[model samples]
Target: MDLDNLIVMANRIGLFFAAQPDRDEAMAGIAEHVKKFWEPRMRSQILAAIGTEAGAGLSEIVAAALTTHRAMLQPA
Candidate 1:
């Protein structure tokens, strides 16, 4: 929705990836992979975070939720 929201979302997603020591590389290495199916706006938000590396802790979860939100917003 906005920058704050985007940051929170990204941070959450980051955390999830960070949690999984095994998958951390796969997750971090393939950051944009998750947003591939997202709408333009969600894609934009995730892209904005691509450079920041701000998605840690709760941010990863938020990002995951944003994906769900994007899916919900998309036309059926």
Candidate 2:
């Protein structure tokens, strides 16, 4: 899948979870959703986006979630 498309999808997931009242809970929801639903390759690509210029398009919430929960999101 395209990186741009993955970024858009991840951001959309973040948007959905952003409605949650608790910030931690929303970030967790975003992480869990991707961990459970996204394939390892997809997960790897998204994780690679963090702190990189290609990921500049990522929404703030999505970028934070990726940065905050990187340990678990990493693909073995």
Candidate 3:
């Protein structure tokens, strides 16, 4: 998985989740229903999108990562 592509995808997923009425619940649903099913590399890519920098808290990044993981699992 390309890290940059994954980040872009994750950021998009984050934006989508952020737009929802219940952000935290959406994040949790994603973590529970999606992250577990993702390929290891895809999971890593999503997590990488949530940077470890001080400005990007781990929890927030994890949320984005999980959301992205879930989105990737969905069929078109």
Backbone clash tally for model 3? 0
> What is the Cα-based lDDT of residue 3 in candidate 3?
60
lDDT of 1 by residue, 1-76 (tens): 6656666655655665666666536353335544554456765655545336543433444444444444443333
Model 2 lDDT on a 0 to 1 scale:
0.93
TM-score for each prediction?
0.45, 0.96, 0.50
Residue 56 of model 2, lDDT score:
92
Structure candidate 2, residue pairs in collision:
none
Q: Name the top lDDT candidate.
A: 2
Worst lDDT 10-window in candidate 1: 55-64
| lDDT agreement with native, every candidate | 0.51, 0.93, 0.54
Q: Which runs of model 1 end up more than 4 angstroms from their true locations?
A: 23-33, 49-76
lDDT of 3 by residue, 4-74 (tens): 55556555555555566886666765565435555666765555545455214334644564645555544
lDDT of 1 at 39: 58
Tell me which residue pairs clash in candidate 3. none
TM-score of 2: 0.96
